[model samples]
Target: MSEIDRNQGLARQIAKNIQDSIMQGRLSAAQRLPSEVELAERFSVSQPTVREAMKILAAKKLIQSKRGPKGGVFVSPPSLDIAAQTLHETTNWLVSLGAVGLADIVGARRSLGRLSIAAACEHAEREDHKRIEAALLELDHTEISDEDFCRLEVEFHQAVAAACPNSLLRLVMVMVNEALIPAANMISFPFRQRDKVVAMQRQVFSAILVRDAAEAISAFDTLIDYQSGIYDIALEQRTLGSRLR
Candidate 1:
């Protein structure tokens, strides 16, 4: 093998070793890693190889680098945004490949939405309420475009998800919302439909504000049912257009 190939292999091995250490809790979050020269000495490799390995770990978000004194490579802390983004990307890929369908997405959303409502009702604080209220206020503006309305809809759901105490559940809710919101925007919303959507949002918010789990769940179901109906219509139209073609 060429010298370059050998260096690449060594770098991958070094990166794997560090990843294993991080995953197995041998290295804790924010723990600084050895300098390039130190790691090169320990791994019996050149400094360039160790630097390449560090780059790999950085791309995986397993480690971070700093510039100044007191600055070096450190294990990255766990991040909900990163986890949710990964999940969203994977879910979108599945939908594109026809491995997951609109029905499946809707079903998952319905199930998760109920759970979020229950948790939010129990654990929502003043800040969470304020976020939901802010989204609702923007949504109530009748002059807003459908694009703005859809964006606020996402903000509103995310605010509710933020109110949930379980980090894992919140992460999953973020993934589901990210996948569903774009699909939801494909259906054109007439003025009447937009008003209905806003009314349902109000119902859900009111129930949440009062910490009423049952009412919130009911309101959520109504909202999901309305959305599902519109999605079904959009799918049918698309299918029919293809048939005509």
Candidate 2:
């Protein structure tokens, strides 16, 4: 076997290696890692390299540090819920700035939505299926208000994106979902059509559950088309205002 290189960027390498171990659970949560000197010796690198690696891990939230003799680097765990919330809040800020609008939101949604649909079709497990179905259940309950229902719709999409097992896609959805919250809320869901809407949602979940990619995409298109009426209302308001002035 070849010896570890010390003259190179060993610190980054060490950081990534430890990060993988932490993410993979090879290092349990709150467990202290090896000392920098020990790792430097093991990797045949300088102590500074090991220290740099630890800093990288800290930046990524993969590890936390402490002081004194008892203190050391500790592993951090993955959290999808927290990740999703970050995505949502950041995306919302982008929208509020006019950095993106409804049309852009719709386009991005369609693309990401298709990707999730395809993945969900191929990889949806029992838990994923339950999550998709649960959204519909909450929508069905009479206590859900219009604003809350719209938020839930975005949450449903974001949740499905999370199940795609792709972190980047989930992050993108987080921003997109937050940015679209206003437009999402403006989409009028006629109370009489609630059942139909819920049924369409079920169909999307069903397609994913069965691994039917085409069906999933088609169902999403159908659902989105119904929701697009919200945009039409906006156009109508703009036109009426122009005539009045």
Candidate 3:
């Protein structure tokens, strides 16, 4: 039993080492790793232990394995899309597990929105403004459905966040925006409500265009506060209905 535990520990360690190599660019994406026998020899572990380590790495999307005459494990490339998706899923899990509440999500969205706006004031370029303007224009269309408006609203926020120079900050905004989807889907905006939201979005965008970070932040807060109030009311009604039943 002790020997088995030691072997398991070794496999985990090996996985970490390999993970580090891939992350640090020592192992390039699509580059094949050594065979299991070679890895075992190099690590001074049994072949089964090396295989176990490979399995661990494979599960993390750090590597992929193939079986045949010309197949071996290769480094999996890093992807912002995948990372954003993982963050979205993890956030949902936290909410489901009661580790995070709706209030926490709102708070995070506001804070991150402020930070991104500040960064954007410093870093936004002509192209970024164009992208944001296009998204903003979509909100003004009168014939669009409530669902389409909601989706475009998300896209508009994403365009604003993308103006920030920091990739990590942009990624965080992506996660926050995606996390709001499940709740956003629950509340359909009436025509008046949609118009109000579009007005707020225009204020935020105009502030951003002028590089007024403070105004942009203020407008964003207003938008978030309004949306939060609506969501809170929906949540309360949901809870009340559930209890009555």
Candidate 4:
């Protein structure tokens, strides 16, 4: 192998060893890793190779570097936000590339939405209720722009997802939002449809607030159906327009 390739292989091996240590509980969160020189000596590699390994770990969010007197590379705690952001970006890319279609996104959202509504109905706290209410109030603004309206709609659903106690479900919900919401927003929302959409959302909120899982799920399904109908109409119109040209 070339010198550069050999060094890269060593760097990956070192990074894997550190990842295993972290996963196996040998290294706890916030525990400072050994200095680069110490790691280079222990692993029998150059300091640059060890630095490459550190970069890999940092990119994966497995480690972080601090500056100053108390500064060093430290194990990073598991972060839901980082994980969710990563998933969101990947999902958006798939959607943009047409590797994932609107129907696929809608189906996934339906499955996940049912679970989220059920969990939120059972576990929603006072604070979660407050968030949903705040989003609802903003959505109810009479003269809201379509962009703001769409954004608040996503925020409202996110608030509902937050009410669910399962962290994994919440993370997946963010991915679903990234995949579906922007695509739906590309289709214009008529002013007449806005009232119906908000009304359906209100039904969902009321059902969840009362801890009525069945009702909440039903309302959510209805909203999904309406949105799917809108998407279908838009697709048909585009097809007809293409044929006319």
Tens digits of lDDT, candidate 2, 83-163: 666566667777767786767777887887888778777777888888878877787766788777777777677667767
- lDDT per residue as tens, model 3, 1-245: 69999999999999999999988889999999998899999999999999999989987778887779989888877777778888888887877777877778788888888998888777889999998899989988989977787778878888888988788988988888777655454442531377788899899989988999999999989998888887777777778979999
Question: Between 2 and 3, whose TM-score is larger?
Answer: 3
Per-residue lDDT for 54 in model 2? 80
Model 3 TM-score relative to the real fold = 0.77
* Candidate number that wins on lDDT, 1 or 3: 1
Every candidate's CA RMSD: 2.2, 8.7, 4.1, 2.3
Per-residue lDDT of 89-196 in model 4, one digit per residue for the tens?
Answer: 888888788898878877998999999999999999999999999999999987999888989899999999998888999999987775578766676465238888
TM-scores of the candidates in the order shown: 0.90, 0.62, 0.77, 0.89
lDDT, model 2: 0.73
Measured on C-alpha atoms, candidate 4 has an lDDT of 0.90
- Which ranges of candidate 2 are over 4 A from the true structure? 1-87, 181-183, 187-193, 238-245
- The stretch of ten residues in a row with the least summed lDDT in candidate 4 is 183-192
Return the lDDT, model 3, position 77: 72
Alpha-carbon local distance difference test for all models: 0.88, 0.73, 0.84, 0.90
Where in model 1 is the C-alpha error above 4 Å?
187-192
Clash counts for the predictions, in order? 0, 2, 0, 0
Report the Cα lDDT for candidate 1: 0.88
Candidate whose lDDT is highest? 4
